[model samples]
Each structure stands twice: as C-alpha cells, then as structure tokens.
Target: MTVSGAARGMLRTEVDRSLKTFLDHQRAVGGGPDVVPLFDAAEDFLAGGKRLRPAFCYWGWKAGGGGDDPAVFTAAASLELLQASALVHDDLMDNSDLRRGMPAAHRRFQALHEKEGWNGSAEQFGAGAAVLLGNLLLLWSSEMWRTCGLPAEALAAAQPAHDHMRTELMCGQYLDLLEQAHGENTFESALRVALYKSGRYSVERPLRLGLTLATRGAPPWTDALCSDYGTGVGIAFQLRDDVLGVFGDPSQTGKPAGDDLREGKRTMLIARTLAAAPPEAAAVVRRLLGDPALGAEGVATLRTIIQESGALAACEEMIKQYLHDALEALERAPITTEARTALADLAVAATTRDT
Candidate 1:
C-alpha cells in the first residue's frame, strides 16, 4: 500500500480500538438515569470526528523512534480525547449545530430533552450537559497521559510542552472571540490566532511530546526541528481549512458551504480580502462578512469579492511557501530517512487534500 493508505489504515485501527476502550469504560461506570444519558450523548458526539489530532500524535511518536506499543496508542488516544473536549466547547461557543455531519453535542442533548418531554429549558440543559461532558473528556485525557507507561522523567519533560499547548489554544480561542466581538481583527492578528490555536496544539506540541516520550533526553536541536516542521505544517493546515470553509464541496467537507463566512470567522483569508479589496468592495465585504443571516446568494457575492480582491491567490501562495519551508525543515532534521519521507508525504497530503 501507498504511504497514505498505510497511514489511513493505522489511524482507523487505532481510533476504532481507542474508541471501543473508551466506550467500554463509560459503560462500566454506569452513572444514574440522568448522567447515563449524558454519557451516551457524549459518545455519540465523539463518534464521527476525523481523529486527526491523534493521528498526528501517533505519527509523531513513530517518527521520534517510539514503538507501536499499547502505551503509545494510549498516549495518542489522549490527544483525541482532548480534541473531543475542544470541539464540544467550540461548537457551544460558535452556536454551531452540526459537526462531522451530525448534531453537535449540545444539539443532541437539546433534542433528547425535547423528545423525552423533560420539564426544563432544553437549551440550558443541553449547554450545561455539553460543558460537563467536555470537562469529563479533558479529565480523561489527562488520566490517559498519566497512565501511559513512559518513564517519569519523560513525562516530566513533556508536561511543560503539554501545558504550553493548552494555554496557547485557550489564548488563541479568546483572541478569536475578542476579534469577532469587537471587529478588531487584522491579518497579523488572524495569523497569530492560527499559529497558537491550530499550529502549536495541532502539530508542534504533539511532535515535541512524542520526542520527549521516546528519548531519555532529546538533543537540543530536536525541539527546534520539530518547531520548524510543526509551524509550517500547522499553518498550511489552517490555510487549507480556511479555503475549504469557503470553496470546498459541502458533500465531502460535511459542512454547509460558506459556514465560516456565516460564523464570521476572522481568518487570514478574510483579513487579506478586506485588505486587498477595492474601496467600494471593501465596504460591502465589511458589511456582510460576519452576518449570520447572510443567504446563499450573499455568500456567493462575498466569495466573488474575495476572489476578485486577489486574496484567494495570496492565501494559496502563502500555503505553498509554508509547504516549501516544511520540506526544507524536514530535510535538515536528523531523523531516519524513512521517517522524514513519511512526514513529508503526510504534510503534502494534509495541505493538498480536498477534505
């Protein structure tokens, strides 16, 4: 099989096994009537995600010379739990209803509340349930890490990186919220959010965590190499996501067309479009950019304005530059040739993939 095929197979196997274990554990813990339903809802929400973070963690571990032991799988699985927690909170914050082609956690809970004729505000119940469930997932993630059979020294070394990842993500999320609320976003600010929110947590820290876990003491250059590689790939990944948010076919993406536009995401593409649009076009864009009530026709018009403003081309260029830098960094790293090649291929697949 091709490398991509092999990676997909590995990811599928790991995700399936991890999810089964997680579900079995949940079942064994059998909370009372109310909480049991909540657990079921959480499981349903977690079921359909792409498991991208865990796959990244797994491959990062392999690249850092870690074997495919059960401990490694558990460690990788922790990242997926973290991802689930983040998504649950993210959807609530975004007021989003759909995720991975199904009702979001909060939405599912709300529907269940209504279906069961519960005597409470379904919205309140849903949000509260989702928040508690998300916290549970976060706790579970930490526990998974604690139980992974790595040496204490390795765990100690990884703790700071892990903390930094979570801290940066929270900060980035807050920054994004602030920008959207105040209409204070700029291209630079968007780039900063992308780096901290998606870049570090999504790629950098995972690579660093895997490296720390694998080696008794990683060389000084190891962290630097991973940083360079991670930043490049992470930036490319977010940019591609931004593109897909607007231009991708909804069938494959499992999102409504122009969902990001509807949400008024302060993405790099939007910033660039605003910056480069003609004066008249800029006014129109600014007026309609984040309007949640925008219709499909309005979204089409905004897309046209962005395309005509040259922002799309600019974003594409930036993606290519990042991909080039990532390849260069990979070449310079002291990892095995096969590992480096695998990383390169994964990077390409990540950035160039349509879904």
Candidate 2:
C-alpha cells in the first residue's frame, strides 16, 4: 500500500479503537435493555466513516510538533462522535432511509416500534428517538474530549475551538433548513451552507483544535493554515461529497442513487447546473429534483442534464482549483516536513475518495 493509504488505515484503526473503548465504558450509565438500542445505533453510525475529521485533527497536532500519544488519539477520535451526531440529525431531516447500507437511526427505531406494536404513532416515535440519539452522541463527544487524559492546560486552550465548532455546525444546520424552506439555492447561499455546515466544521475547526492541543496554545500561523489550507481542502471535500451523492455508486457510498436529488439538496453542483443548463433542461430539473418517488429514469435524466449542462465538469474543475489553493497554503505553513506531506496527502484523499 502507498504510505498515505497505510497512514489512513492505521489512523482509522486507532480512532475506531478509542471510540469503541469510550462507548464501552459509557455502557454502564446506559446499562439497561431499553438503552441498548441507542448505544447500538451509535456504534453502527460510527462504524464506517473514513475518519477524515480525526485525521485532520491528528495531523494538526503533528504539525504543532505533538508526538504519538494515545491521549491525543483519544481526544481526536471524539470528532467521530460529533460527526455521527451530525449525520444522524442530517439523515432524519432528509428522511433518508439508509446510511452506509444500514437502516438509518430513525428507520431502525421505526422498525422497532412496529415490531413491538407500539400504541402511538411509529413515525413520530422514530423521529423522536433519532433526535434523542443524536443529542446523546453530541453529549458524549464533549465528555470524551474533556476526559481524553490531555493536560488541563491543553484542554483549556482547545476548549473554545471545540465549543465553537459544534455551535457553528448547529447554526449551519439551521442555515441548511432555512435555505430549503426559502428555496434559496443561489450560488452564494449554497456556498454559505457549504462553508458553515461542512467546510469549517469538517476540517478547519478540527485542525485548529489539534494545533491548539499540541502547542497548548493557538499560534497565529494556525489561523493561517486553517483558513487558507483547511477551508480550501474542506470545501473541496464537501464538493466531492455533493457529486458522489448524485453520481457515485450506491454500493460504494451506502446511499441510494440520486439520494441528494430526492432530498432536494441545494448543493453548489446543483447551483452551477442551474446556472449553466439550457432552459428546457433546467425546467426538467425543477420538475424532478425533489420528488420523493424519483425513480431510476428520473435519476438518469437528471444525471444527463447535470452532465450536459457541464456542471459536473464545472464542479470537478472547482475541486481541482481548491485543492491547488490548499496545497499552496500548505507550502507556506510553518510546520514539520512530515506534517506538511501528510496534510497534503489528506487534502487529496479528502477531496477524491468515493466513500
């Protein structure tokens, strides 16, 4: 395997181990047959991500000259829990049925309600349970970070960045919903959602958290790296994810084909397509974009419109440009040579990976 691939694999292993160990310990507080499902749902949701957020955090620490301490890994792995919280809420909001080929938390709960022949509305029960589960994961993420065994000084230094990240993510979620409600899929609005919801939360904040923890303080250059490099790479990563939601194979992505279309996601790709598509094609998009029953033919038709409109190519070019910008920023970052190389590799992988 390539060096980058090996590094990612090993990092994934360590992050998974840390998270599993934390969850296992938390089982006591949640020790009951009834609460088993919540923990099970958390585990299933966290099981299969690429661990990119934690990677960014880990590399950020390395950039600040931190060594391989298990405590750092423990702290970094908390990103997974935070990310899982976001995904659970996201799936619920989108009414998505699947995640990584498993029933979404809401759907899982829904099925459980039906199986037990509950008295009230199964759908409502499912939605409530999913919300509670998402909140629980969020709580656990903070707990994990606070208790990751890092020095008090280091933790205090990183706490603001950590708190701000979650707050930003939550506010971004609101912006997303607002955009959907207002039908505000303009390029600028979409970019705003991209920045707050995915970009900063995914890479920039995590990197800052790492750097602060490693140095026991946030260096001025850390802001430079987070802005120029982390934000650029993070936006590219979200853009790539937007493409995969439509064009990627369901087997690889764990979501159904054109799932984003069904959700009516106002992604930059969709925005670009609207800008570039012929009137007739744009009309077709408007007609079919959000129909819950969008079938294979609809997906194929939308795909063709996206391709013919040149939006797919446009988005791809944007990814390339953003990646270039991120690399240029990394070139200027005053970090170890090893960290620079790893961050560069992470930028590529974050933007290009299918899953």
Name the top lDDT candidate.
2
- Model 1 error, position 67 (Å): 2.6
Residue 227 of candidate 2: its Cα lDDT? Answer: 96
- In candidate 2, residue 131 scores what lDDT? 98
Tens digits of per-residue lDDT for model 2, 1-355? 1246677778888899999899999887776988898888898888888888999999999999898888999999999999999999999999999999999999999999999998899999999999999999999999999999989999999999998999999999989888777754888898888889999999999999999999997678988999999999988988999999999999999999999998888899899898999999998998898899999999999999999999999999999999999999999999988899899888988999898
Q: How many clashes show up per model? A: 0, 0
Residue 152 of model 1, lDDT score: 80
| Candidate 2 TM-score, C-alpha based | 0.97
**Model 1, runs deviating above 4 Å:** 1-4
- For residue 229, model 1's alpha carbon misses the true position, in angstroms, by 0.8
lDDT of 2 at 9: 79
Q: What TM-score, computed on C-alpha atoms, does each candidate reach? A: 0.94, 0.97
Q: Rate the local accuracy (lDDT) of all candidates.
A: 0.80, 0.91
lDDT of 1 by residue, 1-355 (tens): 2366776777768766876686677678767676787777667766776666676666677677877676777777788778888888888888877777788889888988899998979999899988988888888888877776766887887787777887888887788788788775688888887887777787777777777777646777677767788889988888888899888887887777888888888899989988898999988988887787888998999999999999999999999999999889888887777667777877887788777
